[model samples]
Target: MYAIVEIAGHQFKVEKDQKVFVNRLATEEGKKVSFDNVLLIGDGDNVTLGAPAIDGAQVSAKVLKHLKGDKVIVFKKKRRKGYRVKNGHRQALSEIVIEGITASGAKKAAPKKETKKAEPKAEAKPAAKKAAPAKKATAKADDLKKIEGIGPKIASTLVEAGIATFADLAKAKPEAISEIIAGVRGNHVTDTWPKQAKLAAEGKWDELKKWQDELDGGKA
Candidate 1:
């Protein structure tokens, strides 16, 4: 079932088990929030749409948690004016777990209860963890340095960020790279992903090398 519920002055089509992030709500975690301003509802072929909002329509959701989003640094500067302003903001967010949608447009259930059970006590046993022998460093320059824009630090950053392969970098959209770059603004590392992806996609290593050379020569 799907329902269009109004949340934070915005309407959203929500379904069961779907997760949506919206404007911050003042409710505590695990609270039930019902949206009465249901604009539309659909159950298979049957669809109910309202003029402004459907009457007797509702979408029910559980507030899984409340958290702050990533810090957004706002910087304003006027060149030669000696005017500068810098501020950091983190948007408040409410992680809503859609429980269900009702035709009446009310949050259906009060909330599900959790039953905690006691664990059985037993005598503690010491478990030894042995360090495994280090494997040969199979990682090579071809594995990383081949990328037009990525240096060792950026490569390490990518690895830590869970991007491990040329295929991964090549397949990723520029916007995805932009998001990471946004996290660490002014890090020139991600600037070359486009060139790297282009080289990797076209299998043109020589062209990539020439391009890197041009960059090094300050001719780019």
Candidate 2:
């Protein structure tokens, strides 16, 4: 039997005893791990497909090792600004071997609940706090790095350009966004940035992620 499962952020077709390398997992080496996001299962002539993911279906595996992948060079340049950045990156990876595939009755591991400590008795009532005007929290910039094709420099540039939040980015036109980042590097495609930011601003993460998967950098 073989199963298509999502490990880390990527999916793979795995079978018993098959070794696979995936994005770095938090589980330690030699530890057993189970993936409940089973997308499909096939056993010879019979096939079971999931509507997104099958309930109670799971793929078990053991972490064999952790390692780094080949280094990739990243170079960025800003037009006529003498701004240049260069770096190298290696993807952290984990090696694991498929142990078993369960068709049903697989229980998901529940997260450990945090214990709450007893609050110390306050001499003054909480109503006393209401007397003081509430201070508004300072708005913090959203991580634009979460958007595909937007690196640290571009994110900083966008933030400095007054497009600090996802909502701000969503309201920007593609042409305006392009002009805003014209000082920075390559031929960037900004047509999808507003769309992606809109989804993020609306808290539609899954839909945004699905759309991101289909995108090439920021291109549709």
Best by lDDT: 2
Give the per-residue lDDT digits (tens) of candidate 1, residues 4-69: 777864677789999998755545578888876676677776676554455466778898976668
Per-residue lDDT tens digits of candidate 2, residues 1-220? 9999987657899999999988665456799999877878888866766545665689999999877778888999999999999976666567999999998943221121124223212312332442232221124568787787788887876765457778878888887666556556677899999989999988999999999999998998
Alpha carbon lDDT at 27, candidate 1: 50
Task: Give the TM-score (vs. native) of candidate 2.
Answer: 0.47
lDDT values, one for every candidate? 0.59, 0.74
For model 2, the superposed segments whose C-alpha errors exceed 4 Å read: 105-220
Total clashes in model 1, counting residue pairs 3 or more apart in sequence or in different chains: 4
Return model 2's CA RMSD, one decimal.
20.1
